[model samples]
Target: MTTKKYADFIYKQTKGVCNIMVEQMFSDYVLYKDGKRIGALYDNKLLLVSTENLNKLFPNAVQEKSFDWGYYKLIHIENTEDKELLEKAVRITYDDLYFQKDFVTDISYLFKVNKRYQDSITKIYNLHITFLRFCYDKGLLKINPLDKQDRILHMNFLNNDLTENGTKIFNELYDKWLVYTDKNDDKTDDRIVNTKMLEKYYLSIIDKLQINS
Candidate 1:
């Protein structure tokens, strides 16, 4: 709902930017002015310098309304997306704004929302990967659900841009995998012992997924 293109916004303001991600977080980042902090934005809210410092610099700065979105507290940060103004935010807030809640993402929700595109994943894969690879990469299949031929045919599902639902499903599965792996890890463990074992059974998982030339 935010017309804001966060990556483009930041890039326009700071040309030497790093990788851009939406719905993720970065720990306390600083703005350098001869190596000094002036202001900060956190969880996307702009906080100003100390009460006194903020008054001195941005005398007219005031609270703005959070944006309207169903089931989410998405706020529109005005004039503050750019660096010049944002620098002052860090010095003022003492840190970026941290929310008690995290961004919401559910893959099932996406599937339901885009029900019209029933096999959107298949379509995206078809448009991109060769049918063979598309069948191989661009899908969300169960780990136990795949046969060698199934894997070979579905690898192209990976090439699909992924409906919001697919992404959520992938993330949920991945998060569970990470937790399971980490919990299984004791000392100096890669944490995916269980998965690695599964890999032995599916070693040729990517064999069917020939990359497009």
Candidate 2:
């Protein structure tokens, strides 16, 4: 069984790499970075998610099944005193899992909005808004794009932190919403069509940004 003291120790050791968080799961502790599970402390042992790069880096490290029925395995780091190696392993594992598996692709797949109305433009807009709000709620976005007060803050974050492609994607999405608001006159039943178009556009932007990142 894992104790809180040991879990806190492990978290303190690896937190310098990123925003590592520890959550109790029964008697063990699972670790997360930016809302993505990266590792865990099982049986008072530090176990990180097994990744190709991490396995290559630590060829002789012990491997164990993550759970009784799960196909995924975890790497056991025996040298708990070596904080440097632990941090490096956590960082590499996090990068591999987050960028390769759980980034924008998962977001798009998990939060896809269903088109229920054929002609209700407001409904389409609201559904898209819900998707963005979901992203914020899930800790994917630092600023809520739907909030008018967060407009400047969000733009500043894009300009300062994200890559050129990321910034462009966000700007294009924001511009699309702005255009929709500016031209509120609906002459035809194009809400469904526009909703599909916007969803595709949003996904493409995420994909491009992920590739560039």
Candidate 3:
């Protein structure tokens, strides 16, 4: 959707042609063949992961951008696009864990040219994931030559000492995000989950919260 070329390692590695980036369903991305989604995008490039993975790598990845929810988990990926800063950013983004809806309490980073937002709960989380998806889509966080070790940083932070108030604040903010998302999106039982986009925001908020916490 963006004109700017993202920092994608897959594009660099395969010269812009990778069919099944993930092991499971190729739904995260619509692979372009002559500009059409023949399948999904999952390579060493980026893929979906679990909530536990989110927390383990979030601190090191998106240290500059984080949020709250206390779930502390994320997916793992081996960035090999040659952009350390961007890979660091993506590592910080919980790119594959947004489908659960058990965590994630904010979405206000979509239009975040500035740190603080006016909408607080609803806008923060929504915008945050939106921005991550945009970055991923536009290859803003793609890195090259991702080391084998770089893909596995699943160290849990739950045992670490997070402030009681910080935890409370995280929950409060996250709750606001939930309400906002429900209000804006359909509240039907059959609602669909956009995990790709969720991954972006999940990591973004986790990164933000770590700093503010």
Best by lDDT: 2
lDDT of 3 by residue, 1-213 (tens): 211132243344444232322122332333233332222233323322333444464434322112221443223344444445323333323223222212332222333543554443434434434433333343333322123442212211221212333333334443443443453444422221344434444456657666431
Q: Which stretches of candidate 2 lie over 4 Å from their true place?
A: 65-69, 101-213
Q: Candidate 2: which pairs clash? A: none
Please provide, for model 1 over 1-213, each residue's C-alpha lDDT reduced to its tens digit, 9 standing for 90 to 100: 222344335435643323212232243232232233323344444333344444545555554333222332222235655586654443333322221122323334434655687555433322222222321244433222234543323232331334333333434444444344333224314333344533332333333333221
Candidate 1, backbone clash total:
32
Q: What's the residue-level lDDT of 85 in candidate 1?
A: 62
**Order of candidate numbers by TM-score, starting with the best:** 2, 1, 3
Runs of candidate 3 exceeding 4 Å displacement: 7-10, 13-50, 63-213
* Model 2 C-alpha lDDT per residue in residues 1-213, reported as the tens digit of each score: 899999989988887876789999988888898888887888888888889999988899988665541566888888878889888888889877765343232222212343443344454445456445543543445456667532222212323333334434655664564455333356333442355556566777678666432
Compute each candidate's TM-score over C-alphas: 0.22, 0.49, 0.17
TM-score-wise, the better of 1 and 3 is 1
